[model samples]
Target: MARGTLFSSIAGGGLLIGIVSWLAGTAPAAGVQQQSPGSNPPPLDYSLTADSQPQPGVPTGSLTKHVLAPGKFFPGTPHNYQVYVPAGYDRNRAIPYMIFLDGSGYAGNNVRVPVVLDNLIAKRDVPPMIAIFVDPGVMPALSDEAQNRYERIFEYDSLTPRFANFLIDELVPEVGKSYNLSKDANDHAVAGISTGGVGAFVAAWNRPDQFRRVITWVGSFGNFRGADRLPGLIRRTEPRPIRVFMQTGRQDLVNYAGSWYLENPRMAAALEFAGNDVRIELGEDGHSNRHGASMLPETLRWLWRDYPQPIAVREPQAGAGRGIFAELVPHRELLPPPSNPAREGGAGRGGQPATPPPAAGRGGGPRGAVYALIYRDKPWEQIGGVYKSVASPAVDKDGNVFFADLAENTIYKSDAARSVAVFRENTRGA
Candidate 1:
């Protein structure tokens, strides 16, 4: 079979989609279709032709390459990145900035990001900004036979806060040492394709204080280690000062991991549901750089539109209602009293004064009443039976204790009645 056909058969025509469709009672149809809020329109051809190249009167920018040594976040790995400084850049002033992942693939003539930036900046379509294109890291092999460790999946696909920390704490600061990059989050943006697209979203989502604009193309928001939960998170968390633009194709990857085509629409809907500034563009293309590169110029324009006008966080819409946020936001009725009335010399049941409880840490008390001394050579009574190993203990409002056992990979709960039971099992090898 042909390579493309083989991949499609393995990914789209496999048991993964079949099982999902069976469970949902509907099968996903083939072909690309726009799934936006309003009337869906055909995607425009943003592909660069002869007319799209460098034009007269447009000042060209400088492209420089640099290497970043692995830092505390991803030790022993190194990365290569490039920077595009727009023409007429002044070192004295802070310039708007953007970071793109999968750097090498985007810096070529086909993408022509630098050229597009020059034209856009000259036309006043986008603010003159510095673009940092960073490639994924790689760990060197110890021997000839051993394969080099690819850091792409771990750095991009895994939804860990460490990647964001690496970008904010390491990469940005390293870049800022030479160039006067804007410190304002609203002046910063992140973009990437495929898995890198998800990484861009993760960076902005985790630290909206550092990045307010995000552009993702064919983001891998599938079962790649909890990324599928992003839509739910967007609905539940307080809306941030973020402007997002997502582009995906109908024939994008559809495998056990997830369907890129469907995930982006879900993300856009969730963003809109949370009252965020979001846009989703669908196309008839597949998982490739052609569509994304073609749309890069327009994407930047939309991202930096109304430049210097700080992106604002919107109030949660009442009509949109709340997801987990409703339970999280503090309310007066939900708060417990500062002090327990019954414990503070107030009447107990039947309007009678409650008995004064023994004072803790006091010198003298009734022999058996001084239970605080239980640790002093006394036979300690176990409220609940012992477990192999206990960790991450927590209690609820009703005095029910919850904990996890790492050895057994089980979560257990002990109620106020001292009864214990397994709360959960097989917690993803936790």
Candidate 2:
């Protein structure tokens, strides 16, 4: 049985995972990359301020706050949650979102989240998405003079799926009361730092249907009371609908708990091998929010790169090694054939065949769908099947094309026409 806090509601339930599987990797022992002196620099103490800009078209409204009590097996504890209303968010127009763990971290120390969000919305660097900042619960002491008790790790570090249930079932529905949150999974994101980072991955890993985009800093994916077995579990399970951006420092925790440096890279490699959508940046610093904070603007941009796009999990071809490690994605649609032969071009949900349309001139149109891959630099050039889903296409000065594979967790170049070829996998270490 799993022991952890759970948030449940009528519509759907999510779990806060606690136990982890510690399976190993396939990389050669000799080529493992270690954190370098420059990369593993020290962490920053204070929060860094962000450069703010105008935010037009964002839904503008006062945030509605809430304090709910845990019940049943949960002990009825109280937790705080906040909603961010963009400049022009409308009930009619559904908006995507980015969720935050530990509201105080971003709302206080790293005020840059909202600031960067405002700037990004204005500059069109990314689409406008709502922000949900939540705090872990703390039970009140019996005596008046008793100190307020904290339960950060005990609640966040576990691998059970209860916490995710709380957000989707309890937190999200409550947010829906004030504004319209897109029910579509493609519009959602989740993020955190430290143990919160591990919790973030656990949430998405358990409920990728609700959270397709994830950002974590210094995740604790080690064997601490059974939470360190994620790398192996990832290799064993079929890929889920997720896009993960992981960041960690060399100087992060490396005590009896586990090494953040070693764990982050190992997890990244496993995600790649299991055919997941993942990105990682290894820095030299301790286990703090400084680096996670500094990269907030860029991270948000990457997390929401493929906005309003659904993330699909590609199964490996038969007879492949381990079978589970092979995955693929076609995130973008190629330029339509001058005339679509299949009519609609894209497949139906669940990769099922689409309904047949009327005759060509009467109502039937082009049904053919080409998985056209395009380059950011050369929009005219047609690249096919480079990445499953991409925030933006990668293009070079000479019309070269490249894209990241979430499953292999690698970046590859298509043979001039975006044909698939191996580029680099971050297995050895960072």
- The candidate scoring highest on TM-score is 1
Per-residue accuracy of model 2 over 238-274 as CA lDDT, tens digit each: 7787888887765656555566766776676567555
Residue 145 in model 2: lDDT? 88
Candidate 1's C-alpha runs over 4 A off are 1-46, 49-52, 318-430
Q: Highest lDDT among the candidates is held by which one?
A: 1
Q: Which ten residues in a row have the lowest lDDT in candidate 2?
A: 16-25
lDDT of 1 by residue, 1-430 (tens): 0122234454545544432232222433321122222323445464674324889877899999899998999999998888899998999999988898876656665566788888888989888899998888989997999998978778987677788889889988899988999899988998877778889999998889899999888788888678899989987777888998887765566666666766776677678656677766666556555576676777777788888899875543333322212112224223312323332211101121133333322222211212233342468667666778889987664446789888888888877566899899987546
TM-score of every candidate: 0.65, 0.61
Candidate 1 vs. true structure, TM-score: 0.65
